[model samples]
Target: MKKWFSSAIVFTVLAVLVAGCAGGNTKSGTSESVDANKGEKKPVIKILQNKIEITDKVKAMVADYNAYNPDVVVEVQVVKDYLTMLKTRFASGDAPDIFTTAGYNPMASWSDKLVDLSNEPWMGSVSPLTIEGMTMNGQKMGFPLAFEGFGVVYNKDLFAQAGIDTPPTTFSELKAAAEKLKAAGIKPYKEAYQEGFPLYHILNLGFAYEQDPLATLAKLEKQEMKLADLPFLNNVFDVLDLGMKYGEGQESLGVSYDSQVSDFATGKIAMINNGVWTIDPITKVNADINIGMFALPLTDNAEETKMPISVPGYYVINKDSKHVEESKKFLSWLHENGEKYLVDSFKFFPAFTDIKATDDLGPLAKDMAAYVESGKGITWTQSAWPVGYREDTVKRIQAYIGGQGDREQTIAELQKDWDNRVNK
Candidate 1:
């Protein structure tokens, strides 16, 4: 099934690119005619997305919008995987008029294909850092749909059983707590390194502590600072060593994402270092389970801080699109109403200030929301790494975790690769 889905996604992406190029001239003419028609006719907008399963509540909201705006028809094309489909479409220059643009690093790779939405009315509703990461050479390329934070998501019920009352505030405290939980017959931490990204995510938490890590990276590229001189990288090694010490017996390399979450939800593990979206999977296991979250602890010498987070994904308009105005209108609506739909139906936490929390939000989600409101969180490091460097770093971390090499040698190799990419 997975192979079939992957193939289908590849085929659909290729088809979209081919169709876009072949029909370019036709679309140009149609766009002019549509603009001439103005308010007299409805505009049909195409949306490319991977998430197709809209809850009934979201469907109702769309239905309501359709009733009010009979002239606009929203067509959603669902793909199986975001990155592969986007890469295929982008290479063909047959990309969708509107699609997701927020991701680690490669966001800049698509800069030429995206529209500048800096002056959009709804721009203020999203985080500026999110905009910064997606922007290339000063052009805003993506619109954030929701925000997320990664941390220690723990079961409150398990904590109570262990006689713990509050979330750990520091790394040492977390280590002590883990020991206590383990003594109570619980796995202290559960993480999956099968997909490799989780290992890099651990490093990202450490990078959040540096002052303008991304900007520093840009300077490092220009030979202003040595990559080895960065303090955050040292912090990353520190945390990984700590995690490795605690998760000694667990086969991190063998664990799949499903098994990791399942272990936590089934009460086999007391905590998991994961993002806010974990609630979705956890709820599927036991809706009554009580979950809580705390920020990843900062370095001992640094002041207490929360890791950077952003709207986990974004919506970007195609710069060369024929339906630019119409696409922008739809995006504006999405920025305003889409957030509410996502939060209410999918339990998403909106990045927008105007949106209120849904009643059904878990306690941990509420805490994350409050943390963001207080301006405590930093943007995720993966979002800012150079496009090619990001994946390379992940692969290196995965190999390191699986015991492919010693830590110093692995990091030095990665540092060299990162420097080469940045300098290039």
Candidate 2:
């Protein structure tokens, strides 16, 4: 793989960029629209988050917030290239009043740029995993808005038509289901590998299930172990090859995430391996589409496979924003009285304790909650990887899946890239 952004250069840029993310006295931001119902302008608190699925929902929620509380307005922006754009905004010295962070590793780069949200009133009600996931070195940096999971999101109607009674629970069953769907002349799975997000997700979850991810990462971080030493590299490569072989057309390599979601909603594909966040976009295309979720079965032992569930992002007040207090207040209001509005507005499982959305939960959320409740949920640790780790891993996986590389060589390159990143 080509040498890309090194750890030193990234940290160097982050050191300089955090200062750029500092906001000045004036609030320059993106609001939903003019508050036609209100007579006066309100103090605007801008938000920048990565979940594009909830862009409209958050806009409406903020509108509702504005309607009730006219004193302040919260503007939400959901970007595709969230990390890069956030850095761009920060470097321009026009950071949003509030921003979203993944968790410890990425947040560590900007720890100084975020306000300490340890004292947030809703923190007590938030899921411990959500809170702990965002915490770094005992500092509570942001509010985890949702407890999310990713697996095989499938079409129930399609599965039923193929005589499959339940979602696949084993890697063998998963491939069998895909074969049945393929035989039925339906594209078994949607692929969007040209985009790095899904590509990294498939491999990350595969390896996550095969090892104690935190322990493995700890050993690797200390140079006590090597990626090549991990016994699950073959299993990860197996899943990657499975997807490359049985999924949709070769052109899928160039497909975008939106196209994947849109096509799936139309019932063209039997399943997709993506995060629960894809539900919103799918429902937007066909609200009544029959959907279900199962852990991406990476093992023959159903008992061993765990759903990849964890907090994807957190809301943090920008330390340099002049409206820090107001931004916190707005975020506080989001969790006011159990965040029922948020639960209703979006289908996600709420991180807040008081909200129990049993009846209204979406299919993917229900599956994720079941795993979390049953202690079968695994952590999403890609958030803890180095900045350029995704690109490096994706390139190697892409090469192998493309038949241009072999498993042993791929494993060696991955280990070399990771070791170099850590040592540098």
Q: Between which residue pairs do clashes occur in model 1? A: 146-311, 147-311, 307-378, 308-378, 308-379, 309-378
Lowest-lDDT window of 10 residues in candidate 2? Answer: 7-16
Off by over 4 Å in 1: 1-42, 52-65, 90-94, 103-105, 248-250
Residue pairs in clash, model 2: 20-90
Error of 2 at 382 (Å): 0.5
Q: What's the lDDT for residue 388 in model 2? A: 72
Model 1, span 220-265: residue lDDT tens: 6677876567776776665666566667433776777799888888
- What's model 2's lDDT at 181? 80
Q: What is the TM-score of each candidate against the true structure?
A: 0.83, 0.83
**Candidate 2 ranges with C-alpha deviation above 4 Å:** 1-44, 70-81, 183-186, 248-252
* Model 2 TM-score (2 dp): 0.83
What are the per-residue Cα lDDT tens digits for candidate 2 across 287-348?
99989788887779898777766666677878888788888888788778334555665655
